[model samples]
Target: MAKGAHGSRQAAWEFFGAELKRRREEAAFTQVELGARVFVSGGYIGQFEQAIRKPQLDVAQRIDETLRTDGFFERMWRKLIKDLPFEAYFAHVAELERLATKICQFEPMLVPGLLQTPEYTRALYEVSHPFATPEYVEEQIQARMDRARILKDATRPEYWVILHEAALRVPVGDPITMAAQLDRLREMVGEHKVLIQVIPFVAGAHTRMGKMMKLMEFEDAPPAVYTEGVHWGNLLDEPGVVKQVQGSYDLLRAAALPPEASLILIKTAAEDHRRCAKST
Candidate 1:
């Protein structure tokens, strides 16, 4: 599969789903029955079969075992999603995010992908990938926008974010783009789509500086933590590590301004950007 090709990604996922349905039938098991063995709901299995959702690696492994396919599902999953726009280390996290019931994120610098606007994302890519083709940057922006869609689903996770003041102060894209981006956050907050808190510069140094971490909780599986740097990402499911990360996240949350106050600050920041743009 070619990298960052949306059509190819969808087609490969469809093929994976078709094979899953065929094998389940060959094994004389209904979707509900298969889902039971894999520890997901019957509706979830149907979604997978219809390519409406992608199963995570562990679930794929369970499907392989349940259908006596040795490693077919697992292997296919790895091969099919490897070409996604995300880095190799982050592909798994992307899949898992779909299944999460809650997501708590801390971003010390730029806005998190799930909350970033298209213009904001494009600006980041332009500066970061200065020599890349426009197509590559657009593909990445599309992927980010796709990732953000989970927030709009009726079954959307309970999303919460803690942003350092720096994220709001940093000028990403043009002033107009920054204004729109911050305005989007304010809108999401007002619509009750997400809960947000911002750590002000006065808070001084605190936990989780110079790092970004996301804690995800699932209904059917243990929680996971994802951390990312410039070129790499890590996913941790180990209970101890997850616990520690959770504690640190709690600390960060405590240091942040209350949601109402944060909303006011965001509004102010958006106005600042808008005024700056107008003055220029």
Candidate 2:
């Protein structure tokens, strides 16, 4: 049997569980009754309602059907697990990315997650999770690829990125992979999907020079800033802090190369990587 949960910081799964419990009660059905309708054991249903276990998609759909909630539980399940591979604290940030009206990012070391290619992403996970199973790594890679679909939507958010020159030059996976990633960046620019600028080494130290920052503005919610360390991330929605971070991001953007020049620089770096790959 799974342990029940009641806590201060309720995760999305917990919220979904609470909602499920409420609906089940309102329908006057016992856990055993609901479990039978969903083809699961009563104990399992109890665990799910308590958020001790996350329901699988099919199970969640069945529960929704049983409760006649018209897919509410199913949709919540999908949103709750959209980025299962990310850290727990970063879940809200992932959700914000999908719904934000505008996204501005400063990447100091590697390609932004939204822009990284599968090959590059795989390489990163492999390095960071040296002991992870190959199957697990592949699952994470697929999740990241799925996240990229947000960029393809016609109603996608406006994206602006400022990448440090080092991110373009660093060899991830191999030179060929790096070149492909750079080419992808160039293609996104050409398609007008995103505007990118490069902060060259010559710019010296500036605001947010050592850390990565993402500022998101939403249509309905207040703006937020997300900053991450090696293993943890913080999402700040306080207006004063968000304003200060936004101001710093603006300064960094001003110091970086303009879009046209940045494109040239990116292409040149891509060519250099291509040559290196050929030589290797």
Candidate 3:
């Protein structure tokens, strides 16, 4: 069965866990015994059963083989993940965004996802998936817009974003789209909805110039750092690594233009886009 929507991801996971436990017991295998077959630790098996962690696809397949469920676990894994709006690797990050009390992000060459306009998102998707059907592209665009709604919630996280000047100057969609997107950023800053800073081109050779990172803090759990590369993402929670990432973010923040100045830059960028649009 397919999960319904955003809130249903947890329910789907719980179902996955319950089914795993039932099948494991039916096979008369202890968690340790099952772990041996799946090449994971007994504690890891327990974590899966408790839904404390999600297993990789290969592990799910191994579990299916070990329990002789005829690919039941693998199918369930696909159902749970495939229905998500985000990419498989980014699904967990979307979940974390809802739980975070504060979020700090640095983008080197693009506007952060939460601030992207539909036209801008469409242009990006079209370029990335040249052969994708219009329906599929629209679906992805809607998903991105839905994700942006986190900022609208009354208990929204404290959002802080640092963008390199390249993000502002690069034309995403046409001049019209760029103008609209920058105007959106200007509105967010003007309303005090978010804290934004820009690292101008004048500030060269800075830390995190080629990396995009997000730091999220939760009310009860330890903070985490997320970094993404082409087609992959890594979520880091080790205390040492988190501390180091936090230090790097601090340095980047120090190198940025303040909120007031950044807002001005954003407005200027919007005007430039407007002029370009009029010319073309």
lDDT of 1: 0.88
Residue pairs whose backbone atoms clash in candidate 2: none
- Put down candidate 1 lDDT per residue, 1-280, tens digits, no spaces: 2345656777888999999999999999999999999988787788788776778788999999999998999999888767666887788788778889999999998888988999999999999999999999998988888888888889999999999989998999999999899999998888777899999999999987888999999876678899998798878876899999999999999999999999889889889999999999
Give the least accurate 10-residue stretch of model 2, judged by summed lDDT: 1-10
**Candidate 3 per-residue C-alpha lDDT over 110-215 given as tens digits, one digit per residue, 9 for 90 to 100:** 9999999899999999988999999999999988888888898899999999999999999998988988999989888777668999999999989979999999
Query: Which digits, one per residue and each the tens of the lDDT, describe model 2 over residues 139-207?
Result: 888767867778988879999999999999988888999999999999999998899999998999998
Prediction RMSDs, each to the true structure: 5.7, 11.3, 3.8
Query: In order, what lDDT does every prediction score?
Result: 0.88, 0.84, 0.88
Looking at model 3, the pairs that clash are none
**Pick by lDDT: 2 or 3, better one:** 3
Which residues of candidate 1, in runs, are more than 4 Å off? 1-75
For model 3, state the Cα shift of residue 252 in Å.
0.5
Q: Judge candidate 1 at residue 158 and give its lDDT.
A: 95
